[model samples]
Target chain A: MTFWGDYRGHGHPHESSWTMLGPLVVLAVLSIVGGFVFNVPEILSGMFPIKEATENGGPGEMVLTGISVAFGLAGIALSWLMYVVNKDIPEKITSSLGGVYTLVYNKYFVDEAYDAAIVRPLVQGSESVLWKTVDAGLIDGTVNGMGTQSQGVGSLLRLLQSGNIRSYATWVVIGAVVVIVVMGVTR
Target chain B: MNLLEILIALPAAGFLVTLFIPRKQEHLTRSFTLIVSLLAFVLSLGLVTGFETGKPGQQFVDNVVWIANPDIHWHVGIDGLSLWLIILSTFLTPIAILVSWRYIHKQVREFFAFLLLLEFGLIGVFAAWDLFLFYVFWEVVLVPMYFLIGIWGHDRRIYAAVKFFLYTMAGSVLMLVAIIYLYTLAGTFDYATILDLFRSGRIGLSHTEETLLFLAFFVAFAIKVPLFPLHTWLPDAHVEAPTAGSLMLASVMLKMGTYGLLRFCIPLFPVAARENASWINVLAIIGIIYGALVAMVQPNMKKLVAYSSVSHLGFVVLGIFSFTQMGLDGAVYQMLNHGISTGALFVLVGMMYERRHSLAIKDFGGVATAAPWLATIFLITTLASIGLPMLNNFVGEFLILQGVAQAKFAWTAFAAIGVILSACYMLWMYQRVFFGTQGKEPGETVKHHMPDFNVREWLCVVPLVVMMVWMGIVTQTFLPAVSATDASILDQAGTASALARPPVPPTGGITHGGSLHAR
Candidate 1:
């Protein structure tokens, strides 16, 4: 058995693409007709369960299904005819089809459009800049400041331990006051 | 005897044991905590098996007179509403302790002690039948969790801890005010008595006053549910938290919000709840979509899962507000589903982080070759979180969507986007982490470097994996237990909405008829 893509070698293999259109169109029509037949009953039933309907076949149902099948076949034939007519066209026309295909493939650049509209302003805005800068500078700076402040306080406390006559007198007075405050509070 | 006291006491015993255990013997502390948690879990399991689903309501009624003069009783009970949530909490705590056995090195005894203490508070909150005891337990949950986050957390631990503490504390304080007001009206501190009065229309509240009280409770629950906009603190907490901390926080602690909404907010203020139901669904719908969109763009895997919690829990809120039997059931189911799947994801993420020391998705690649079992577990869990059919998440999410569909087609339609976005982000993350080559080229360094699942990791995750499949297939086992509570809540919703309908037509007719006569 020959597969669909297996016959794509030399000599008028390109013509086979046009020949394959007839059955494709016929199948598409049959599917459309089948879908309409299935769906028309549902629409006619008006959202109610099938059990609710007193009778199944009315004149309206028969006519609707008939028209659906007719339209399906017409659609199939037209599609096949179009495919055949377009198949032997010039390379330029074929390349334009590829271009159209590419656009459809890329979803018509909706993502790019969204980026241009929303993300650029969000990323480039002053608030973002401020957030980034403050995040890096102010937040980190404060953490750094705490370390430096602790070190500076330790150094200042170290300086206090240096012995001096004035300091000694102050220390004695402070000790006397502490004792006095303790005595007063207790009393 | 009400099982409530035992629920609180079992963990209290664990907490007491932790104090006596020398702080230096970390292994002993963990083993004791694990045993205590196992005891509590067994007790919860007893509740699950013996629980009579259709019994009038609020089983194992443990009411005792704590204060005679003021008329406050130590009232506590388990009901269809809290039964599973309590089980989920107790089940995870022991697993959490086991997960932390190797990871936490310093002050390990203190860590396990805080974990048990935290479990005690959570169980107490769920089991408490008295308003005051409920409030006390609500605050009890905060302190241990605070220490857990602050003491054992990662870089910026203090910031995350403070943020979590402040956010929850601020919401809960207003809930205290609301509780006091309800107490004043009811002249009692028992939840059953207050609910009875509120339901009977004996406790009078103007629409404005009721709406205010509802908002107060809603805000507290929202912060716990961490419903969107109020959910800013969660990612930071999840990222900085220790592995077990993230597990309990995501799985158990977050349910406090939805639990409050069901147990307190809706039943107490039926009229106001009905009035705000639409608006609340709008918020929930926004959360469902917004969380997914945010998660889709996250580079960090842990934060991505954290944000997905926001998305997934939004479905729970949607189900609750939907006020349909299916919706409410789905909401409760989703709550459990979120805990299991997201908890497993966090554990998996934590395992990777332990090995690589990075949460960035970009840092991982081609790990499937080296760590096939780990990758496989992650894949199953990722599919579950994405609500793929035949997984636990699917049942809850599908029920939620069905409930939403019945209430409002548009709301469900909007929520459907979240499902798509979830698949996109989760699969993309999985592909990045596992499916491709680790290094730029297929080299020996990348091929054989990453270690796969070890014995400990396998033990930790095997139960979760089995559950993810079992719960997904046989959700009937879980759903029937919550059916009675869901039905009652749906009835209340119907009554409130039905009452509003009669007034609407009369007012519309009066205005139209009066204008016609004047003309």
Candidate 2:
């Protein structure tokens, strides 16, 4: 089938379009009704003519309720107008204040700034200084250095183990003389 | 045989029997090892049944003389402190062996044999009553663990193994020298005798002598507990070692260090321990925060887990240094909690590695879609590791924070940040691996290879998960057993030294109180 034919024949535009708006409208209406329903307890109590009813009733409460409802309805109407009736208004306003729009669009560049100021340096420092220089170079170097130093000492000591009778005799004679001289001096 | 002797000897006998098992009979070897570990675990439970709560001294005593010249003895026993740790050792061995069944295919006989040998050494380390015996067992642990890592470990295993050996040995040699010096002064290698001698003021130590001896043992245990700067060897050893090795290393082996601190360091040199506690607490806090921060950035899963262990164990050290009954109890309990949670995490990671053969975080995603059961268990373990309430780690971490808060409020507040950081890293890793839409790159043909836990793996992990919940819920059940011992240790330390901190009130019978002695 051709694309246009498929779109016209298969797509139920009226049903699908209503489905998108259905939940939002229902929620908005329910919330508005619910706001009044929440005052039922107070209204019912007022109708009972209790002794404290007149004491509790005042113009302040009425005025506060009127103001709240006025603001709430105004907000809802504005949202509907901006979102559905005149969708281009938000884009126009944002474009008019281009600097603030860009600021909000880029999330104030906080993440980029952090990456530049903190994360990059941290990662680079850890890799170069901590891992490379400290862990691998300094710490491991010192550890391995101990091993090599011991090995060097062992090899140097091994030189004295050379199997030579004349060398052993000479070393024994020198050791005996040194021992005798040390003992005599101490005594 | 006496219960403690059998508890120690069963594993030794298992090691001998494993030696005779033909290398080709892998199943037989595994079964034998499991059976022996199971028996050891069952007998270790006898310590619980036979143990009298609130009792002050060591039970299941098995003392015998071994050498005459330096007055050494084959003395071994269990107290409230050592009993749970002994049970922890025996408990993890069977699980360790079971987890290694598939992972360790080559040198099957030697692997199981060394594992059993390591178990024997670990039990001895916990149970030894004599200084010389403790030292012997301590060194014995090093040899087999070294071979376990070097033989069956991942690439770079040799370097890891050697570093472990050299680092541990360097700390231990100083300890050996100190032990010899103490022997000369007290004329015996018996722990009780030397402790009594020092306690009774018969063997007097000048200030320098006290500090030196304390440091000698402190360095040894700290390296093992791996507090802060001394902790560099742990990540390397943990990452390079096989799964079972990592489990034991994180679970029971690291406890040896903290246990040593409780068992020997504080009691032997209270003045120095109390004097140095401030700096030690500083190190502990540093380790707690440093470890978690480092873990947050780890690309390798095993390394991340390894760093978490450093963080968790730091709390244990912090608790011990806090020197309150709650702190020490939490420290001991945390030792066990870490074993369950972190060990289980390692096992899960190992299972994943077996399937995918890669431990890099980027290598896997949306694993839950493929293996929901495995993912669920991973999430549970991750939560437990992060100290979620009603999980094992939470009770321990809470108690530790409570304890440290009393001792050093600032340290506790800072250490609490580590808890948040732990959650950050563990959950972030979990999310990256399990919750995403794709576990691998698109068109990756090997996606079907990964599978959930089978019956054997379930058997391995079920006990851990159960214990994690059990310990978290009924902390009261475990706390009382160790409370009396913790109190006595602190009491002795407090009485021996002119401690600057206020005396910790006795913790006996005060369940859930906010005091340092809270049961």
User: Which candidate number would show the highest lDDT if scored against the true structure?
Assistant: 2
DockQ of predicted model 1: 0.05
lDDT tens digits by residue: candidate 1, B174-273: 9999988888888998888887676565776877888899999999999999786678778888989999999999998999899999888877776677
Predicted model with the maximum TM-score? 2
Query: Considering only N, C-alpha and C atoms within 3 Å, which residue pairs clash in candidate 1?
Result: none
TM-score of chain B of each: 0.94, 0.95
Residue B89 miss distance in model 2 (angstroms): 1.0
Docking quality band of candidate 1, CAPRI definitions: incorrect
The alpha-carbon RMSD values of the candidates against the true structure, listed in the order shown, are 10.0, 6.5
Looking only at chain B, model 2 earns a TM-score of 0.95
Q: Each candidate: what lDDT?
A: 0.81, 0.86
Off by over 4 Å in 2: A1-70, A106-128, A174-187, B435-448, B498-519
Predicted candidate 2 versus true structure: per-residue lDDT over B1-519, tens digit per residue? 589998899999999989999878999999999999999999999988998888778888877888987799988888889988898999999999999999998999999999999999999999999999999999999999999899999999998999899999999999999999999899999998888887777778888998999999999999999897788888889889999999999999999999999999988898778778878988888889877877877888998899889899999999998877778888988998998999999999989888988888888887888889999999999999999999999999999998878776788899998999899789989988886644456633335768888999999999999998999898877888788888889887766653322454555321122223323
